[model samples]
Target: HTPGYGSAAKYIGSITKEVIRDGLVYDQQNVTLLEIMGRNAGWLTGAAALAKCEDCEGPDMIFLPEIPFDVENFMKKVEELHKRKKSVVVAISEGVKMADGRYVCELTGTIDYVDAFGHRQLTGTARYLAEKISREVGCKTRAIEFNSLQRCASHIVSRVDITEAFQVGGAAVKAAFEGETGKMIILKRVSDDPYICVTDIYDVHKVANVEKKVPREWINEAGDYVTEEFVSYIKPLIQAELTPIMVDGLPRHLYYTDVEQKQSR
Candidate 1:
């Protein structure tokens, strides 16, 4: 996992719990769709399960990019849940695909825009599904996309992730000073009980361009949600929170302009 993943997971988990609470405000039946970012991995989407606790029942279903999505099955599940509950929350990855290997968002229309890496600008997955559920199930539906907020939400950053990020950078510098080349620093989990992580250097060539996906065993047999083991693995990463420095009423952040002005002074 990457340094920023832990912070993003924390934000997702916290927001999912809040959304679940908001969904139950009314007596009417409603389906809330949370669209999480995951091009090929489901780590962020799975984090929604972290919201599950004694007080809060997490999302009713979680769809990941690793699994081939079935629209019929999804609709059936939603209908069943709607019949029993007043509110149904679902967490879905933007990159989730049909068995035919086409993105769920592409079903609405063609995505003309593509990034430099040839990846489509994946969006509207939640909106399309929400509309479909409303029309088919005849109930209220809402689509919530976290978008860039998932990655840039510095206000709720994890202390563990922040500290490890610094450690990784320092380790890289140390390795370079020791005449090491073509090396990348990686976090090695030495202990799970204490959640101790240590930095180790690996060949950059071997690490580059390799996508580490969530293991198949981590997902449930139904492929609709993650397992308890998955939650246990991520729980440590988001254990501690880093409080932001507030100025007046907002969190204070350093900008490049401020640095330039200080240098001039």
Candidate 2:
């Protein structure tokens, strides 16, 4: 989960908070579900937990692929949250599956194909969960798939992450100049409170293709939410903001597919 993950997560945390603010103003009961992008890793989905703070209530519940999802228990949890608050927000990973390894997307019959990765294509996870919650609770439910918007939202990016991304690339180039082969650049967090961090090189064999999961200790006992430890870890990464390079009030992209299409014609 490198390159664009931190930037996308910053967007996730920001959008989630804004959605919560807008949802609470309504007098009627409703359920809002955000489907985050994460297949095997729940790292992106876990960012939803960062939306919580002194000012924002954040997500009422969060479901990650790391934990087995129980529909009966999920519905009951929603009912309980709805009883306490009119606006109940839930953040779920697109890959959240049951104990038997079946995805919730199967319930809606939305999975019709697989990608080159041989994994089932995920698109309707949020809608499936949304409709299910609507039917069970008889409330107004909305499903928001942060999709490409999460990656493209330049306005919601984190400066710290962008700087680190640049630093990592530079380090990689430096390593190559020194004739270092089979190595990867990794961010080794030196401190958390003051948010001190630095990049370090590691052997690709030791670090590459290895899955570092969100430790169970970082997750709460209920397994539905993350602990403060997780929050503290991500808090620094989201700090600082960057202004996108704009042209005529629009953020300019390095390339536009439409322009290339027109030129081909």
Candidate 3:
């Protein structure tokens, strides 16, 4: 996971809890599909599991891009969950694709172009799944994408994430100044209990152009949800919240635009 990912994941967990609270307002059964953005790793979407603390049920199912999307099985899974709970929340990574390598959104004829890196720009995975499930299961379905909100929601930022992010940037700059030209800065776990971590420098040649998929063992056999092992792994990163300063009735943000405009004059 990248430096900003922990904060984004923390944002996702907070929002998922809010969505679940909103969805269960009425006595009627409902399905809320949250489309989380993560290029390939389900690390961001996996934050849904973090919401399953003592008071929250969290997402009933989490679909990661690591596993191939199966339509029929997904429909069945939603149906079963709907029968048991009035509110069934599903978290899906936008990059989730079918076994045949076609994105789930592609089935609906939504065309997306590839980037210079040949990565498909994906969106609308939740909407596609919502429409499909609403037709088959005949349930009240709502779909929402976190989009840019996940990255910019500074109000609910994780303190752990922000600290690590700051350290990584400084460490990278130091490494460069010391003539570590081909090195990339990465966090290596120092301790899990006290949750200590240290930044390590790695060869950019070995780390660049490589994508790490969530380990197959991290996902359960059903392929619908992540194992507790995965839950334990991500929970610590989202441990503490960093509350943003309040201005008037809303949270204040530090934006570069205003500063840039002032400097230009």
Top of the candidates by lDDT = 1
Model 1, residue 169: displacement in angstroms?
Answer: 1.1
Q: Rate the local accuracy (lDDT) of all candidates.
A: 0.94, 0.85, 0.86
Using Cα atoms with residue i matched to residue i, what is each candidate's TM-score against the true structure? 0.95, 0.89, 0.92
Cα deviation of 54, candidate 1, in Å: 1.7
Tell me the tens digit of each residue's lDDT in model 3 across 101-211.
988877767666888888767888899889888898888899999999999888887888889999999999998888888788998887778778889898889987788
Estimate the TM-score for candidate 2: 0.89
Identify the superior model by lDDT, candidate 1 or candidate 2: 1
C-alpha positional error of residue 136 in candidate 3 after TM-score superposition, expressed in Å: 1.7
Give the clashing pairs for model 3: none
Error of 2 at 84 (Å): 2.4
Write the residue-wise lDDT of candidate 1 on 82-122 in tens digits: 99999999999999999999999998795789887688988
Output the lDDT of residue 237, model 1.
95
Candidates in descending lDDT order: 1, 3, 2
Clashing pairs in 2: none
Candidate order by TM-score, highest to lowest? 1, 3, 2
Q: Which ranges of candidate 3 are over 4 A from the true structure?
A: 255-265
